[model samples]
Structure formats: structure tokens, C-alpha cells
Target: MLLFDFMFSETLNASLVQSSLVCLATFSAIIWWLRPSRSRSLPPGPRGWPILGYLPNIKFSEWCNGYQTHDVMCKLAEKYGAVFGLKIGSKDVLVLNDYESIKEAFHHTNMNDRPENAMIKNIDNLGTGILFSCGDKWKEIRKFTITKLKSFGIGKRSFAENITIEAECLNSEIAKIQGNPFYSRPLLEPATLNVISSILLGQRFSYDDEELHFILDNLHRNGKVVGSGGALLFVPSLQIFLKDKIKEYRHNLDVVLKYFRGIVSKHQEEFDPYIEKDYIDAYISEMRHNKDKGKQSYLDVSNLVMTLGNLFAAGSFTTSETLSWAILYLTKHPEIQKRAQEEIDNVLNQNQPRLEDKPSLPYTWAVVLETMRLATVGPLGVTHAVADDTRMFGCEIPKGTMIMPNLWNVHHDPALWSEPNEFKPERFLNENGQVEEPPQLIPFGTGRRSCPGEQLGKMELFIFITHLLQKFNFKEAEGESPLTLEGSLGLTWSPTPYHVCAHSRE
Candidate 1:
């Protein structure tokens, strides 16, 4: 016991010494690197510790409670203007706060790649998927995703029909609640997942499917956990100590991977190689057709699994969470809900809401837009990296610098909006009663790396919200606390747990 204790103590002490030395080296490098170099033209921002950087100023509890990382950047931007930098650990992240700066920088080839994170590297399929990849691999997969998704008719009537079918299932599931207060998270999650799953897996799960619900529940639970724990992704030394947290994240994604793998294996056994039925079959068909090209081709079994699953996982959470926020906001301010419903009534008038009705139902669409801006899901909208050394806003952005577009800042900047903090849908409507999409209202982002799933997400959000509002009036359930705008920031900005009483408008 004494020998074991001695060895353990020695190991612990050595780790501490290593950490301390790293700290010292980090500071020494910063001090030497920042020593009045006229050639260095980095942006103006906060000065952090040697290795620790600005992480000391970021409070995890703040993000957990309501304040998000993007919100932190916004406050810092108040002092540092729209284009500023934050040294996080050993990395320098250039934060773009305004629409103009972000728009300008995002399209620059030198500023349009993705960052490498230990956390994502560990979760990603050998860093082979779209969300955290770079170079030719990223280009190939991205082009493939865009082309395949479009070929599958992403924004067509058949696609809307898929979403509409899910809406019918969602309504039936909500009706099962029998007008009692229900947690809308579970009810809404499946509807969104089902639509995306159909494209990726060629099938959808029933609402009661245990594995389906497990993926959904963990997505909500782990998005916040992984997002909160994301600091460790940048801070390497701390990651080893936080093994359990990393493992949990791995395990959550593995569950999703496991589900996808099973589906792939089933398809593999039945893969006809010549026929393409869905996204999976299409890829498999391509792989079989291109086997002679060998490694020259990016098509493979692993990419097939991770790419499709990543697409599936990415689609489910944020869209559903945004809808949840919309419900919460509309319920908290019944006046907004009433106005939205009246618009629906005026246009559809008991007829089922259709995508064609979108133009006519400007108020309802405006309310949804307001929710996305106020809630600001995926605030940072994934970290970007510079493709090459570039200059922006009169500052030098070297190659490999992390670029973060603070969409939350753009949405909430007082100078950009009439009342940034207020939830007013009228801000989106013009004197002509047509919905005006503000240039600054960039929820989906822009440029080559912008979200490819934007159109599909918008379709699902519109169909789901219009249908739900048309059928039911959402109110705070009895014995529940008043709905709060305070949300938990995970993969997306999500509302804290709240229940709603659904009254059938019929």
C-alpha cells in the first residue's frame, strides 16, 4: 500500500510539474512573440495568461445559466469593436461581431476553413466528416453532400411532403397528451429527426422507439454537456483529467454511431450496387462503382457511416430546439401568439397551412424569425479557420487562426436592430405587410462553409410551427413557473425545461 501510494503521489506531482512548465513556456512565448514586432499585425483584444489565455474570463456557469460564449464575445466587442481576437489557451480565435465584418471575412478563401479541436477529433470518425475536416477531404465531402442533397430534392414538394407527414405524426403524438401539460422537447424532437433520418437512413423511427428516443434525449442532454465541456477541447492538459466527461461525450455519439452502423450493415447486406434508393444507397452505389480508383477516391464505408450520421445528428437538435424556443416565446407573450394565430386564421381559415401560405402568413413567419434571432441557436455557428494568411478590418489574420462569427452579437447589437433585446416580430415586417429579411439577420450564416441544410431546416420550422399553432394554443401549464427566456447553451442555444398546456383550437 505504501509503495502504491508513493508511486501515485509521484505521478501526480510529475503531472503538476509538467502543467506548471507548460504554463511558464506559454507565457514566455507570448511575451517574446508580442515584443513590439512591426511585422506582426494581429487584431486588438484581451490579453490572457501564458497558456490559459482568455479562458479565465469565460465562466461555464454563465453559459449554463443563460449567458453564452457568443454573448461573452459580444460584451468584449463592445470594448474591442467588431473585429477582435481572443487568445484561448495556446490558440488565437478572431471573433467577427458585426454582419459586414463576418460577411466579408467568411467568403475570403484565406478565412473559410474549419478549426481542429481535440474534442471533435476524438468524436469525429477519424476526423473524416464534414463538421471538423479540412483540405481536399472536406471539399470532396462538402461538394458530395450539397450535390446529393439537392439531387434528392431537398427543397421540393416531395421533401415538404415528408416533413408534413412527420407533422401529422407529431400532432397525433401531441394529441395523445390529451390537452394536459406535456414536455414539448420529446414531442418535437422526433418530428425533426424523422424528417432528416428519412433522407440519411431512408427510414424514420416511430416516436416510441427506445433507441430513437435515447438518441434524442442524449442529444439534448449531451449538447449542453459537451458544449459546456468544450473548453477542455481547447485546453489539452485538462482533458486527460476530465476523462469521464470525454468518455460520456464519446459514448453519446457512439450511440448515434451504433444506430447508424446497424442501419448501414443492414443496407450493406441488401446493397444492390446498381440501384440508389436513398442517401446511403446512393453512396454505397458510388463506392461499388468506383472501387478501381482505390484511395484516390474519398468514398469508403467509414465516411459513409459518419457523413450520413453527422448529417442526421446535425439536423435533429437545433431545428427542434429553435421550434421549442418559438413555442416558449409565443406562450410567454400571448399577444404575439394571438397575432400569429390571427394571421394564420385570416389566410388559411381552417385550411391546413402550406408552404405556399408562407408569403401570405408574414406575421407567423416573422415570429419564427424573431425567435431564431432572440434565442440564437448555434451562436458561434462552428469555429472557422483561415485557409491562408489574410488581412481583415485592417488587421493581419495569419493562416491557421481560428475565426468565430458571433451571430449572437450581430443579432443583438443595438446599433443593428431597433430594440435588440426585445422580442418584437414587427421588426421583421414592413409597411407593405411583406416579411423583410434583414441583411444582418443571418441565422444560417454565409459563404462556402455555411450550413447546407438551411433550406430544409426552414421548411421544417415553418411547417411544424404553422401546423402546431393552427391546431393548438400553447399556454404555461398550471403549477409551472413562468416561462423564462433564460436558455442553456449546448450544441444550440436551448430553452431551459418548461411545460406548455396545449388547447385544441378545434
Candidate 2:
């Protein structure tokens, strides 16, 4: 009886211990399941559904409701702070909303690379272009392109002469309109396209050319599609639903490339190594040199075609759109326009504005700066990628994470600019009546990957605006509804379609 009692007690103890172990494991698992899965060091963000992640949440933002992606991002920034994270589809995206964060993030060497997307990959097969390429390829092509652009007088007085010629052509085109209210884009786009064309192809097409019209039409359509189809970059699976848009975008791109390829072929047939007539000639010369040396080279015909496309697409549309926005703003605010014209008249004294006169025309320069700030073209400048595992704003950013610099938010931040929505050129002016460019006003962006055409763009704006204001007065069309200050977002943010009467100042 004693031995039986001992065995029974031992069995009971073993059974209780087994039950306790199972209960402990079950409790621990429940706790683990309930806890946040994100690491404490990661940037705080809204929880997302499995697989789909914050993609659905972003779609619900103003972007899907006919507003801009930058607007949606700004609203999210207000809720989640300046630096926020969102798991967009399978990608980790970190949006930097404030100027400091943007500056810091962009200045980092590891943050200089662009994120890969299905759209970019499809458009640039070998990824040889300067805009969307990465690593040594980007470095090499960009350096070579810059050197060639400078050699070709991109930001020099000689280039300003080319811009002046274009400006005169534009004025002549406007003069032919005879102060009639007309759509500005039709006139403005061809003018800007010609300026870039003069450098790239050593030629310019007349505004009436069918080829010019074809190129402009396709490019405009592509810009709209790029902005609308941005979601495909995040959720590539969305392509199934947006196949039509994808198809259209690709078609437009192919049309532009085909046109450029024909131009490049002509340049090749007429190639002169001794005297480089244009960027194409310079590139062809370098390509032949590389072939002669038998060195591996990125300077192939494919890269040249894509590079030319990048230059044209980037160089033409942005300046023209900004000028359009400036016209709209001036038309809406005639008083400001009058002041700017008065400044131009006082500075130039019936002479056409020149690049050398920029300092003398501070108010005019301020107007250009103010227009850029308010317009915020290229709102989300370009998506950057984290090249390696990094920590930013006290949070861990993993390798391959995408970075979005919210330039719109930075330009419109109420704390930085009083009445940020108001178009006040005086904001860029100081008590000394000089243009004061704040560091926060980074319209062309900052850092190594900033717009290469920045100086050229600024020169164009200065020369074009000064020349236009000097010659004509922009005013709203009679019988038309009041133009909205609100802009439609595309590859660039541009004013809604509005007609303006370029009443000749003469």
C-alpha cells in the first residue's frame, strides 16, 4: 500500500507539470500574436493588411479621389509626423516631408540611387539613361552628359543668346496672335522645345511642323499617364487593372523614341568627328573613340537615344509648364504683374532682358522664384532608394527602401512661408529690396541627383518672363470663367487649361 501511494503521487506531479508547460506555451503564443510585429526601431506608421499592406490605405487618400499623390502624402505627414513609413505593396517607402529631413536624406551617398519600377524598366530597358539609372552607369553617363552640356554652352552667355533667339521667336508667334486670347501651351511648348532642340540636334523645328506637334502631343499624353499610373510603381499587381494606361504610356514612349532614333540616325550618317555640331555629334565621337580603344562602354546608340529622350522630355515640358503657370498667376494678379513689368521696364529701359541683367532685375527674379515655389512642379521630385541598410530620423531604413521627398509639402509648409497658398513675390524680397532666396525654396531640389538642367531652366525662366513682360501684358480672356489657382498634377504640376490675352505692351 505504501509503494502504491508513492507511485500515484509521482504520476500526479508529472501530469500537473505537463499541463502547466502547455498552458505557458499557449499563453506566450497568444501574447506574441497580439504584439506589434514591426521592430521598435522602425519608423512609426499605420498598420496594414497582409500582402496588400498600406497600398489600399494610400488609394483611399486624395490621390485616388482626383487629387495629387503629394497632397495625400502631406496629409499623412500631418498625422504621422514629418518622417513616416508606409509598406506600399511589397516595398518599404519612407516619405520625407520636411526640408531638413529631405536635405539630410538626399545628401546621404547611400540615398542617391533611384528605386526600380516596372514602368521605368519597361521604358529604359538597359537602364542607360541618366535620370533613372543607378551606380557606376549613372555616374559615368551623368558626368559625360554634364561635361558635354557645359561645352555646348548650357549655362553660358552664348546659351542665353540661343534662348533670346527663341524668346524673339515666341514673341513673334504671340504677336501674330494679335492680342487674341489663346491657349498658351500650344505656343509655349514649341518655343521651349526649340531651345533644347537647338542644343541636342543642332536644329529647331518651326512651331507649325507636324513632327513638332506629334512629339509635343505624345509627350503631353505620356506626362499625364505617368502621374496617373504612379500606383503601378508601388503595386505592380495593379497593372492587371490598369493595362490600358500602361499600354498607352508605352506607346507614347515608343513614338517619341522612334522619332529621336530617326534624328540620331541622320546625325550618324552626317557624323563629323573633327567638329562637333551638337550633343549627338559629341556623343557619337566619344562612342567611336571607345570602340577604337576596344573598351567596354555605356556610350552606345541605345543609351544615346534614351539620353536624348530624357533631355527632351525633362527639358521641354517642365520649363514650358512653369511658364504657363507664371502666365496664369500673372493674369490672375495684374497688380503684381504691373509691378513686375515696371521692374523690368526700369531695369531694361526698352531693351530686351539679358542673363547679365539678372542682378539688376531682383524683383523680376523674385517673381520667377515665387512662381516656382507656388507651382511646386515635380512635387515628388523623384523617388530615391536606400542603397544600404540605414538609420534615418531615429528609425531603421532597410536596404532597397524607397525615399520620396515631398517638395510640395516643403514649399507649402505654413511655418516656412506666411500664407503659403498666397502668390506673393514680395515674400522672396527683403527690406533692402533684393531677392532673398531661402534655403527652403529648393524648386530644383538639392544634392547630387538634383535636376541637371537647373541653371538652364532658371536662365530660360528669367529670359522668357522678362522678355514677355517687357513686350506684352498677360490678362484673363473675356467671357471666360475665372481661372482657378488650383493646378492639375501630371509628371509636373501645371495650371488648368486657361486662355490668356497677351496684350502687346507696345
Candidate 3:
């Protein structure tokens, strides 16, 4: 009887202690909520649920469809005006619609950091690469990559020659298809990969290389998965809800990383820093130099992998997808197609088109520009995060806020362009029939985190598209008369599978 009574007393005391702790926690939360430093004026936005944010308004159905997603966001921008707020999962994202706002927001150094999301958040090592990294690490890598790419022939004639050769190979591959209805991916992908791969590893994969094909296919699949933005992509913990998808994501990334690792490992042994070869050699030299200083933070193995991964992913898809758009647009508009062909023929005249001819082939270049504007490759570019408390055009954006620059809105704004819906390459042409670079045509985005691969991509598009038009004509398949402009939006937006007959001009 005495033992039972003593146990009951102990239980009661434990319950009382638990109650006190709960009360203390409750009080602390209340005090924190009321604290002046804890609250600030967030931009106007729709309120969301406890964990899930404004995802309800931005429905999955619309997101799954590329065109529909833009249409929805366009409507929201119309209602929300130039600046509004949203909560993508836990991310407090601020949408900058107009060109001026986007320019100003992007230019702010405080707004330069890449937003922390599931994609980078769950990375084995957080903030390691050029694309998803933040702060000094990102800054260091971006600058280093741009400088190295220049030395390795990215924006130079030598690089253009490399792309031209790839174009020749691509033309040959397309010829093998014999003008039959075929998916453009298999042909376009390998050629694009070869260009970037040559720049990175100093070698290009043959079209029939099975291992290379595996990397290309998975790279594309991963790109699409990343493009299909999700809660887990923005909120890492939500990955718990997508066990199967997370497994696939990890597997795909592993395959690509393993392939790159093999290349990087090979380069580590054969790399000669004193003699410049490619991006890999240049990076190894940097790592070697920094080793003595004990400041080799950014030039290690993992970083090399992530940076190369991004370069591969970014350089490959957007350019190829833009080419896909080119085929779709030009084929659909026979008159436009004829004009482009005329320009190519006049400029080259029995010679293969070169980057030197880009300036001379104004209409052909204009077609490329218009395609970029019409179906912007990166519609919602890499999301950025606010570094500190900042203001943009009177909107108060607190620290840790995410910035979503709607390239679609900027490209399609009625106030910015007349008849924005119409496919008019001539708009990019001047009275003297020269190609004019539109200040607002920011398909690759603007400011700090904007695509460093833009110049390379432009050169590739011009060389490949012009050469293809020079060699053959892209035609509609028997039943695929009207090529649908509808695209499947992923990390990059690409056209839906459509059959095109490549007719040899010879």
C-alpha cells in the first residue's frame, strides 16, 4: 500500500513538471510574436495554410502544362500588378513582372543570392555549385567559370568552329533519318551534349556511344523533373512525402555525377595546368595554385562535379529546346521559313554558315531572337533570395525573401511589345535590315545570377539553325500539319513531341 502511494505521488509530480514546461514554451512563443524585431511589412500576397502556402491558387493542373502555367501566372500578374507575394511551400517568393522591376531587383547586390530550395537544400553538400549556390562561394565560381570558358573558346571563333563541326555531324545524323517523321530529341540532344562536353572535358562523345547516350537521356529526364517545380523542390522536408520520386531523383543525379566523376578523375591524372587545354585543365591549375595558400575552398572535387553538372545541364537543354522552338515556329510559318532560307543562302552561298556570317544573316539571326522571345527557354529563371532587408520600386521585401522574375510576363507584356502574340522576326530587324538586339529580350535573364552561358548558346543556335536551313528543310509530317507551339515546361521549356520531316536540299 505504501509503495503504490509513493508511485502515484511521483506520477503526479511528473505531470505537473510537464505542464509547467508547456506553459513556459507557450509564453516564450507569445513573447517572441509580440517582439518588435520579429515582425515586418511583407509584400501583399494571398495567405496560405500552416505548412502549404499559396500552392492552392497555383494549381498542379496548370503547372503540369507549360502554356497553361504561363497563362495562369500572366493572369496573376495582371491582378497582382508588377509586384506581389507568394509562398511556394515555405518559400516567401516575390514576383517581379515588368522589365524595369526585374532589372532593378536583379541589380541589387542584396538580392543576388540564389534562393535556398529543396534542389540545393538537400544537396549532400549545400551551396557548392554555380547555379544553386549562394554568397561568396557562388560569386567565386561564377567569375572563375566565365573567365575559364573565355580562355577555352566559349565566346570566340575557335569555339564557333567547334559548334560548326558539331552542326555538320548533326546534319549528317538527321540525313540518316531519311526525311521520315521522327522525334527531334535523339538527334538534337547528342549534338548539343557533344558541344558542351568538348568544352568541359576536352572531348566529344560519338553519337553512337551508349554511355554518353545514357548521360544525355538522364540529364534530360532530371532537367524535366527539376523544371516540374514541386513543394519538395522548394521545401526539402516535404521530400518525405515523395519517397519514390526522391529515389529516382537521387539515382538520376548519381548516374550523371558518376559519369562526370570518371571524367574528372581521368583529368586529374592527365591534367597539365601549365599547358591550357579546356575547362577541366584550367580548374585543376586553379586548385593547384590555391593549395599553397590553404584557400582551396571552391576548387575541390565536389564543386568541380556540381559546377560541371550545371554547365552541362544549362548549356545542353536550353539551346536545344530553343532549336526545337525554331523548327516549330519556322515550319508552321512557311513564309518565315522561306525568308530565313533566303538569308542563309545569300549569306553562305554554297559555303557552310559561320559565326562570321551571323552579322550578315540578319533575318536568320532575327528568327533565332524572335523564337527566344516567343518561347523563352527559362521562363521562370533560377529563383533568387533576398540577402537582407531591401526595397524595390516601393515594395518592401524583407530579408530571406525569394524573388521570382517572370520572364514570360516581361517578354509578353503588351505595354512593352506591340502585338506580342504575333510571331514577327522582322521586329528585330531595323530599317537598314540589320539585326537589333532588343533591350527587353532577356530570355537568359539579367543581373548577377543570369545565365553565363548566354553568348555560347546564341552562337550555337545561330550556327546550327542556319546550317540546318542551309542543308535541308524542316517540314510538317503527314498528319502533323500544324505544329503545336505547346511545350512541356521542366528545368527548361521544350516543345511537345511532334513529328518533323527533314528534307535534304541536295
Candidate 4:
């Protein structure tokens, strides 16, 4: 009995000693970390918890099947000054809220380099497309896309012809509604998808096609999850622990990838140098020629497929949502809607409006600009990471710090935008009938990684809005009064599903 007690005592002492030693070592390391390295200049923000840093202060809720970190991050920036530091897991992220700091970091500083983070590098298939890529690969792809876009009738007669066909199809479909209150999802989403599909894939799917429906459904889910701040932004570490959400993300990507792979494979099997139909065919043909000559090429099948998916998602969703908002805005404010219709009628004159016609339709363009500003689809713009330890706005930002540019703040700031919340299109036009310049208008973002799809997106928006206004007079659906302005948070902040009446113009 005495010997057993002695053994127990020894074991207890050993455990206690080990625990004390561990505590001491942790304390010393923390002290060293707190000392602030001479080379490091992290931006100032609210102090965080022990070990947790500022994690608790970060609002992370999984209420709607995903995290709401972006909303939380914005609120934090409001509380703390624009450029603040946040410790998310082991990494430190700097939040740049106001225009001044974002301008300095993104523009004046012009450090448009890919962040050195594992997550970015981890996206397997999408290796250096026009988006989320850096250095040589990005430069080459971006330049190639710019040249290809111009060649592919992006701002030319062919593109306008394609848009006109899609717009007419959309008009016919909306006409079938017979002025009844109906959900915009069916008409708006499919029409926008068809426009982009025609542009990128060189084909359009019938509204009833089963395969297209599957593709749209998968894409919608992927966008929803990524757009949700929690899944992608807040608890990325905790994401591994959540098996179901992770599975969904992978499954969603896989399904989309399968469709993309099919496209790439078919393009490969039916390659003809003499005959190239669209962007995909051209890209595949170029890639094959490069490969044949023993040259290293960046636009491999995988990258091409992923880029298509990215383009489809961005192009389809943003344009559709913006048009939806245009309809909603018109319904809510009929005066503005009437003015837009008048402008379109006068400018178009029974002819399909081309991209060049934007100059003539100043008021219509202003409404589009204002809608972009007010809605700001990708609200918290894609998260940017610092490539190196840097100082900005008198703060010491460490390397691999995730950056959240609260574009919402920049867009809605009373100082920059007069009568910020009001849906005023006149703010976008000057007396001479030109797009009034605002150097800080960063809807497409700035720096090296700005959206390459800006021109295409603008064209889509212009055509869709013009066509819709010309054909229909939108009105609020019964019981859906006081149309909800709230957007579901995710990679893109989309308006909550609401029905509106597309009263056909007699």
C-alpha cells in the first residue's frame, strides 16, 4: 500500500513538473513575440486575447449554414480605424476600410503581387488563370486574354449581334409571364447565363436542358458558399473539422470541373487549325500549337476549364443580379425607370444598341454606375493578402496578412458620395455628358489583380438593362411590398429572392 502511494506521488510530481515547464516555455515565447521584431511594422489595431489575439472580437456565426465573417470584418473596421490588424488563426490580416489606405496600398504602392499563402496555392486546378495568379503566368494569361477579347468581338459588331439575340430571347420569355407577379430568378438568371454561355462557350442552352440546369445549380451553390464569409474567410481552419461543408465545397468544384473537363476534352478531340469557332476553341488550338513546338504553355486544359467556370460564375451572377436590381430600382422609383426607358428608346431607335452607344445613353449608363456603387455585388472585394511584412497607415502589417478592403465604406462614404444611400444616378454624370470621373471608383478593384472581365461585364449589364427597360414596365409584386434591400452574404452579396411584375409594354 505504501509503495503504491509513493509511485502515485512520483507520477503526479512528474506531470506537474512537465506542465510547469510547458507553461514557462509558452510564456517566454509569447514575450519574445510581443517584443515586436525590428524589421516588422504591423499596423495598429485593437489588442487581442491571450493566444487567441483578436479572434473573439471577430464576429463568426454559422447561423445560415455558413460564416458571416465579412459582415463582422466590416463592423470591426468601423469600430477600429480603417487599417487595423486581425489575428485569424496563426495568420495576421490587415483591414483597409477607407479609400485613402486602399489607394495607397493598391495604387500608389502598386504592390500588385500574389500573396504568399498556402490557400491560394492550394487551389489545384486553377493554376494562374487571369484571376488569383501572379508573376509570369498571370502576366502572360492577362495579355493573351486582352488580345483575345478584342479579337473575339468583345466591343465589336459580332458581340452586339450575339447580345441582341439573347436580349430578344429574354424579351420573348418575359412576355409569356402575361404581367403576373413572378420570381425574377427563372427569367433573369437563365437569360444572363445564356448570354455568357454564348460568349465563352460559343453556345447557348435551352432553358429546359437538364445538363444546363445541373450546371447552374452547382455553380449557384459554389458561389453561395464562397460568398458566405464563414466558410471561406472566418473559420477556414475550422472548415477541415466540418466534414459536410468541406465535402460540399469539393463536390461542387468537382461537378463544375467535370463539365469544364468535358468541354476541354471535346475541344481537344475536335481540334482543327483551319476552323476555330469561339474562345475555347481558339485557346485550345493555341495551347496545342504551343505544345507541338516543344514550348511550355500556361493555359493547360485544367486552367482553361477552371477559368471558364470562374468566368461563367462571375459573368452570369453579377450581370443577372445587377439587372435584377435595375428592375427593382425601376419598380421602386418609377420616375427613374421612365427616364431610363425614354433614354433607351431615344438612343436605340429600333436598332440594337452597341457598346459604342454608351456615350449617347448617358442617363442609362449613370443608373448602371449608381447601381454598381449602391449594390457593389462583390461587397468585400476578393480578399487580398500581403506578400511581405509591410507598414501602411502607421501600422505594422506582417507578412501573409489577409487584407479586407471595405469597398462598401469607400462606395457609401458621405464625404465621397453625395446623398450616399439615395439612388441618385445624376451623381455619375457631369454637365458635358460624360462619365464623371472618380479616381476612387474601384468597383472592378485596382492594382495588378483587378478584374479582367470588366469590359465584358459592362457590356452585358448595358444590353440586359436596355433590353429589359425597353420591353417591360416593372412593378412590385403584391405582399412583397417595400422590397427588401438586404443581400444574402457570400462571395457575392446577392439580393434576397423577391418577386416583381414585369408588366409588358402595350
Error of 4 at 83 (Å): 1.8
Task: Provide the lowest-lDDT 10-residue window in model 1.
Answer: 1-10
| Model 4: how far residue 140 lies from native, Å | 2.6
lDDT of 2 by residue, 118-183 (tens): 664654444447776788888888998889889999779989999999999999999999889899
| Leading candidate by lDDT | 2
Clashing pairs in 2: none
| Model 4: CA > 4 A from native | 1-40, 48-74, 108-110, 113-128, 229-236, 394-396, 432-434
lDDT of 4: 0.69
What C-alpha lDDT values do all the predictions have? 0.76, 0.80, 0.76, 0.69
**Tens-digit lDDT string for candidate 3 (231-281):** 445565444445556566678888788788888888889877567777888
| All models, RMSD in angstroms | 6.2, 13.7, 10.4, 9.6
Ranking by lDDT: 2, 1, 3, 4
State model 2's lDDT.
0.80
Per-residue alpha-carbon lDDT of candidate 4 for residues 142-247, written as tens digits (9 for 90 to 100): 7877777778878777787787778888888888888888888677788888877876677898787887788789887766555432323333453433345455
The residue ranges of model 1 lying beyond 4 angstroms of the native Cα positions read: 1-40, 60-66, 120-127, 217-222, 234-238, 292-295
